[model samples]
Target: MSVSKQADIAPTLRPPPALPADGMVISANFSVGGFSKRWNHCHQLANFLARYASANEDDPERHATLLSTFFNELLEAIYRNHGATGEIKMRFRKKQNHILVEAEVPINEQSAKFYNHAVQLANQPDPMAWYREQLEHDVPDDDAQALGLLELAVVYGSKLSISEPTSGDWLLLAIQFPFTEVEEL
Candidate 1:
């Protein structure tokens, strides 16, 4: 079933399936990472992921920049939405024409619902308008966590999905980025 449809029917929405172990370019477990350093970590990880993913592209710099922007957005969303305690694991793999990112974060059932709601919003016909409305209006704290995914869908054209909760309270999230088109942006 589609991730959105699965989310609608299942109350235990969690993480995506494990990313293939063979293709990982980088992975990190942020269980002990200080919350104060999340901004730095997110940007640094994004830059590294972008650089590695864009190495063979024509305009490496442009592609890396674009990738970094979207990657940081994804990382920031995890930082904002994850539950209080658990390993936030992130893994990246390079595909033929895109980069696939899989993340498993500790999230409660309520947060899972919020994520599903955000995905639904992002899939709407006018996501950009909804994104603009989010920025212009004061949203509740829970809803504010939805903005990054919305921006990724609306502004960057990334594809996102979530898997059913597996093993524990972890929420699996998958994001696919078609980096080849970045140079033209």
Candidate 2:
């Protein structure tokens, strides 16, 4: 092999140092450590959006728009209609480049049906727009049961995966949003 080729193929002994910030959340199902404890997952995610927007640092309106977009999806666990009372553990983690949000929601007999319906909608190619059409033209009272998953899939292009139950009734829905942070010039 040529000398130039050898240099190109050599392994990097030292990986790039992680960010100096030390922030993250620690939950049973989720833990975030990289930025700082002061900054929550939502904050981190919003920052990514702001960076992507290339907006001014102090621009409240830009930040608000981005935050709203992220918050709307984050509120899914709140309006979830379970058959019985159960706890859903939400996990938000900051990876090297992007943020990951997960929800471990319990699946009862009634909620299992909801899960099936949601899975179908989420897997559909045009779920979000289709649901909107249903609301606009056909059914005014469309429940929009799968809006969260649909938006995550359609908007952020997030890779969403649902894990099957292994030990208990809890179903794991994980959303990964890959982002690149803009360096300060």
lDDT of each: 0.75, 0.52
lDDT of 1 by residue, 1-185 (tens): 54566547756344442433236667767782464355666688789878876665566788888889988888777776777776778888877566788888788777678777777887788888878887999977766878878778877787788886656487788888776665454
Per-residue CA lDDT of model 2 for 54-139, tens digit only, reads 23224435444544465446444323533244565666555555446567766666556666666676667876687667557654
TM-score, model 1 to reference: 0.74
Pairs with steric clashes in candidate 1: 14-165, 14-171, 14-172, 15-171, 15-172, 16-172
What residue pairs are clashing in model 2? 22-35, 22-36, 23-35, 23-36, 23-37
Which window of 10 residues has the lowest lDDT sum in candidate 2? 29-38
For each candidate, how many residue pairs have backbone atoms clashing (under 3 Å)? 6, 5
Native-vs-model 2 lDDT?
Answer: 0.52
The CA lDDT at 155 in model 1 is: 79
| Model 1 ranges with Cα > 4 A deviation | 1-23, 32-39, 136-141, 166-168
